[model samples]
Target: MAAGARVMFAPCISEGLLLRVQSLLYVGVSVESIMQRHNESVEKQGGPSNCNDLLTHSYVRRQERVIRRSIYELDADVAVSINMWVENHQSHVFFDEDFSDVDPLTLGIQTEWQLQQMIRFGNHSLIASDSRFRTTKLKYPVHSLLVINEDNKVIPVAWIVAPKFESSNAHKWMRAFYNRDQTKDPAWNLAGFIVDDPLADVLTISDVFQCSVMISFWRVHHAWHKNLVKKCVDNEMRATTSRRLHQAVDNICQQRGSKRLFEDFIEDFFDESDFVDYFKATWYPRIVFVVSDSQWGNRLYQEFHKPRAGVTMRKSKKKEEPVLEDLPKEYYDDVSAFIL
Candidate 1:
């Protein structure tokens, strides 16, 4: 690598390491296999055979092929293979960071490396905004944005911040307006922006590119989650919420030379109306993923160990969970069920 680090094949992948990567780095599913699943789903949905009954030629073969290739690269990359993880429901569009598997020492390196890449060369716009949890009426609960690196550091390119805690009166009225329950999953309160170029696609790049980010940190926010109280924040006066870097980002994004998907701050999370129901984006999982351009791995292969063909997994001499043999095989039709 230009960074002066050379990776040598240390050993064959141990089943333990493979399982760790599958469960820890990737959350739990095979990125390679899942993308294959996604591509297959997209093609079918884009078909005249549309199941959702919507016409969408969104993922033609060429695009699917490109995505498939990217996925493979990530699965095989040293750095990426070592740190990425798969979470529940592997097909979800956004990936949550897996906090359990991360090694503390490398977190800084991984985070900074990724922050630099996204803010610098990866074509994207960063965003931030204040939002409320759906149930708690916790206004401007927590704000976040796609960290983009432009000045050689991962910084906010698009910034959004939540309002200070809404007054009790305001919260009551807000709940009444939305019929939200503070006890239920909170309302959706995240600010997101899109980049103007091909490389700017968030979900696509996130799955396709291998990054230096760890899976442990990106937990998905979910529906049905108790609405987190958005403790009132200090928003009386502020230059910009991109942590004092908004002006610079705005200047760069506004430049005729820079690429921007939407020229103005993304106001659609609230104004567009269709993004989600008013009940709240909270109480639901928020999928967050880091998209980057690097893929590296530290390989150390280990021998495969499993019971023989006739032996059930649970009954393997070690008494694992019973491996039922009667489950139906997943066919193409079954695989086509996840496109949304």
Candidate 2:
């Protein structure tokens, strides 16, 4: 019997093949592709006429189990090392609870330098927080707390890895940074909190810290544009509608316009379209917070909407030729000598 058929007929997969499959999987190669490669290799070696039957889904599942077991074994050691490191750096790292106690782990890390910078630059400033996914194979959402420095550069103050991006998880993440004891600290001063999701992130920030909440303009603009594209008839109509809507949004976001102006613009430009109705129902109420002079509106405009200084290139003035009358007598003598 051929080696391929012998291996398949055996009760367990061969050690060499298992190792090869593990290596391929470790480097992100899919199981289907690996099976195809194995079948092609068997055919090239003339090992089996039914090369496709040599590799089966059962083999892939078995290899996956072995890989998982190996990873679990390694993770035990890694967990110990991580514990030791965290104990050594307790001031810079934080865990919501023991890993054994939580289904999905929640951990936050901030360096000493980052903490100092946050205190120095983040206090009474616009602090923004958001969540990002697909950053790792673990598939956990990474929550980040950031602030703008004196140079207007965005600096991350803290990061929390959590199971989900819900309001409760966000509250837990923020609580890791500022508990009830630290809330009274003067350095906890925050002008406003900017977030992508008003429901998930804003609920926690506003309730816990009692700070002004500002919705990200990019998210708002994206929603407006996406809905306009879906509701408009054609490219021409979409472009014209988008231009007028964008102007209104810009003015509102920049704190230069009011709800009355926006309503008037919508009424004058649009004639009872689905887009208009959606905008009124969904986003109209939020305009108060976006353009209110007393609260988040002014703070948001000050931090993000204000124009920044930029370097401008000026045209160089042409150098004027020196007049012969203004020239020294030696210059005229030299010119006359050269002519001769």
Candidate 3:
């Protein structure tokens, strides 16, 4: 038995080294960095110096996978695991009526602490929401509801993991809060709402909360930049056109009760009737009617125009920002691809 045990253990990593690796991983050390340190330690001991011989990247990745599975049940079906978790925490977590049937599930989460924060800071204050796409391995979008705290720091009060950014999905996400039993007494009567996509979220907010809606200026600017890149031939034309359009928007937003139409302001800058018409139809109304409204204009300017540290008008920028036009072609092929 002793001889057999020795034979079995001879080719395996040392127990001490395995424990060390586990410890480092638990403290959040990167696999590559840990492997480099292991290599240095082996060299100091005058042993085989190659990390691959002892601690390969694949080995480390496997260990990471094991650790993550132990922590989060990574091997389980995502929807099943999420539903189980929600079942355990039913008081705070919420799901859509057809959660099981929905191709891409919608889940809303608010802890007791978060609910307190919302009641204290969010009531009668401007609430903001935005969605982050391709956030998880399943490529599900995370929708976040935010409010400014007493310390003047903007913090997320609730989170929604939704399938898409359509208005119907937005309605389901909003209903999670509106129908929450805990908040029924006080009710979530928001003074206003700020959202990145006015078309997707404004109507939902109006139906659910009956609040004034404001569009994030930065998101609108990014949309203009992105669309101009597609519509214009070269960078020079795009830049020139973008600058003129931004100026017109700024002037329009700054002016009180300005009757001049957005199309009229930009008509002289662009000779391309197609791009002009597209912008007019798609974006012009969103800016002029929703963002520049008298009820919300001053608040928008104060909150977004003069930017403070860590105060973003839109969702935190991802490593790769997706263009509005590219999303449908890229993601619509398999909505079920996001179901895991």
Candidate 4:
């Protein structure tokens, strides 16, 4: 366009050379394709062009090699850079740089740090955390620990970008600040765990580390799954109800020679008069859904919160053990709530 035309008219640049450079500079147009097009255009005129000398694949690779760094090297470089940044900024900022506790498992590769400044800024009193695995060109699975600050912003604390997602890696990430000595580790203490099912390995965590942090299943995901199940069940019930209604009408017609009579009877049965409050009744479930929400919740609750294989000790006496306490509300809530 206008810019290209101006460049083509430059004092030292020829129109032919400008056109060749423009063709090579297109996004996603490979050097090989550019070379082929140049060769065809040159052949139509006379012979091969000199543009291939500059736009060769080897030359492109050489240029890339000058700038590119391996992901492993980049990982180490970034860690060192962060360490330097913290050292420089710690005097001015209210941040903690106590990542000296090397995880014997990770060998201090993934150390945890906290920005205490956000406590003065963020919304929630709680520390929000989530993990991301496999985030490198090498496909090396690096589990990163991120927490929300006072501004409700995510701050990366540690990166266990090890190739595996083992229990030891997770334990190492948590164990970095597992110091009982109050003098060295006064601020770094885990109050509780708010994690999904995968990270809810609370029982197994006891073997490696000995600290009681209450683990709660992520509520949003649990509610979403329940909603999905409810939708699926509702769709199935609607399909089955329609099929059954059609079959019932056909049977009535064969017996009484009138589909209208069956339709009238069905309409009257479904009609919620002052005497028949449809919302409060459970009898309609059999004619529609397989089970009511309460019935389904009760069934699921019993199955999920089934008693573990041991009795509790009460005053040196054995007692029946109970399931998980303060179960999530989604289990027992009405199906109408999960309609969305």
Candidate 5:
């Protein structure tokens, strides 16, 4: 067994050394010539006489086939089994090799009920979403959703690995978690969503649940698009433009403070047509504006523009009535930390 193991890895070691030499010195050397020289050196040193002799062996190929089969069989077995949180925490399949122009092949197994709970209950509430691809040519809309926990950290809630970014796929994901009866209790609902896109489809989840949710554009994407729109003269100018805009935003936030500057910030940075479309897509109007301090909370309350309560008018011996000023908006000591 040890001898067989040595034979299997000998070519890998030779290939590694040859690759390093080719990269550093012999840029024009072909792989075939490198292997031939390696084989001759091995034979001269009384090692394996022919490097390809073991590499091309039928037994080694058969062993590889068996190992791959074993993994597939294990994936099949795991797919058939279900336990508490088993499907939630880890991907069912270890490897998936299929690919198409639209979507990368994904080997994922999820139970319908598991997906349902994640959507309906905010089972993982603090969420981040984005699509990823392995190669530039092979595009797979693999969307990942992460849940933010009490510890102020994000964890994976689910993955929507598919060929297309169809809204139906997103709807299907929510269908698993939808329960019409649970609308009465806000605690068991979605709190917020953080995403890179304008969230045209994702915001629907908020409407269906009838929950107050905060949605924010991914900060990095905000900067990226800002730079992209500038049509700069060069890469350096593009970077400088983005940096300046970012700095300007920071200065505004720092100078005026978050609550006072919230509307100004929106108008200054995100007033483009694309930004408006994204903000208005779902039309829920609960985008979160992060404030710098507790005082800003009162400022936010003022901006909410809720009507003040009427005061009792008194008559005493026809005395002139005193005009009272509106009471200042009070801050709460224990504000709901639902979205935080």
Candidate 6:
């Protein structure tokens, strides 16, 4: 962890634990598939970690208030996570790597692109304000990092995410406890731990809903890839984002287990353009796990979720009415023909 960087962590042990779980994945990110493979991977299962300790203190009248208050006190460069409320949070600045115009070679693990965005973060705020943004609220909290030209003073920035996370993970709870929208088939593609099977965490288990990460061989048109970069950037909230690349440093954070995040972290991107994109990518804890052990939960959040006296994450409520969902311009294409 970077000095002065804070890592905030929280475990979801609430009655709505599943909701929090759903909040972690982008639309279509599968939790059930992962669990299925987790079963086949671990042959030597041990005791499972206790979830009893995950519950918040009952003494706290407003638990949500506690969560909000926690954020208000966080220091800059703080890294925080909550398995219950939020999964991972990191902050870093990054610059593009110079690879002779050749995109960096990826490991044999095979990479794929999951998203693409042409709109910059600033303008999207208004566009996202539409009801479509409700589901995107939980999974991503990408904030832009700003610098003062005069003295180079660093300041943190933030923006609102419309559409919330509506992936398969989000629906897991509605189907389980609610019994209203369970997966079409219950036997496969489930997120809950089977408890009975213990050593099942070896395979990547990210095939079905994952974005196949691939190398980019051309100059980035931020406008064209803004959406895709933002998806990864939002997920990789903690990373360094800068214009200068350092050849001496290897991505140590990702080698151990953290997701491959850009060294650059963008709290906000005010410019709107397809040619320029900014944000960082990387995993939360940067810790590798031997999921074969039942104690995996103990380490599920090993490197994040800070409860230090002065560190936390924060959110502010706006009083505007819900944004309506109407297109700004009428299309010349025949409505019936285009509807199909």
Top lDDT hit? 3
lDDT of 5 by residue, 205-242 (tens): 55564433332323333435554565344566456445
Clashes of 6: 87
Against the true structure, candidate 5 reaches a TM-score of 0.36
TM-score, predicted candidate 3 vs. hidden true structure: 0.55
What lDDT, from 0 to 1, does candidate 2 have? 0.56
Q: Count steric clashes of candidate 4.
A: 4
Considering TM-score, where higher is better, how would the candidates rank from best to worst? Answer: 3, 2, 5, 4, 6, 1
Error at 233, model 3, angstroms: 6.8
TM-scores, one per candidate: 0.16, 0.47, 0.55, 0.30, 0.36, 0.17
Clashing pairs in 3: none
lDDT of 3 by residue, 160-266 (tens): 77766553567766776866633544555665666666555556677887765655555566667677777877778777777666665555455443435465656
Q: Write the per-residue lDDT of candidate 2 for residues 18-124, one digit (tens) a residue.
A: 54465555435688888787767777878665343355667786777766654343335645645665676577575454454445567676765556556765565
Pairwise TM-score winner, candidates 3 and 6 = 3
lDDT, candidate 4, at 198? 32
The lowest-lDDT stretch of 10 consecutive residues in candidate 6 is 331-340
lDDT of each: 0.25, 0.56, 0.58, 0.34, 0.38, 0.22
After superposition, the stretches of candidate 5 with alpha carbons farther than 4 Å from their true spots are 1-124, 133-139, 150-152, 163-166, 179-187, 212-215, 219-236, 247-340
Name the lDDT value of residue 148 in candidate 3: 70
Off by over 4 Å in 6: 1-61, 78-187, 190-207, 210-340
Per-residue lDDT tens digits for candidate 6, residues 1-340, read 6542221223334433333222222222345543343333332343123233132223122444444564452444222222111222321111111122233211000001100010111111111111122334534333221111112211112122211222223232212211211132232221111110112122221232121111111112122234445533443321222221111012321223222222222213323222123222121121122222344323331111122111011122453222112211111011100000
Candidate 5 clashing pairs? 104-140, 116-176, 116-177, 126-148
Per-residue lDDT of 1-340 in model 1, one digit per residue for the tens? 6443212211233333333223222212344544454446547677323323211123223334443554453466444542442222233212222222241111111122222333343322222111221316422232222332222222322112223222222222223312221122232221122221211233432232221112210011221112111321333312122222233223322232121212232332233233223223421121111111122112111111122111112224553233222111211111101010
Candidate 2 TM-score, true structure as reference:
0.47
Model 1's TM-score against the true structure: 0.16
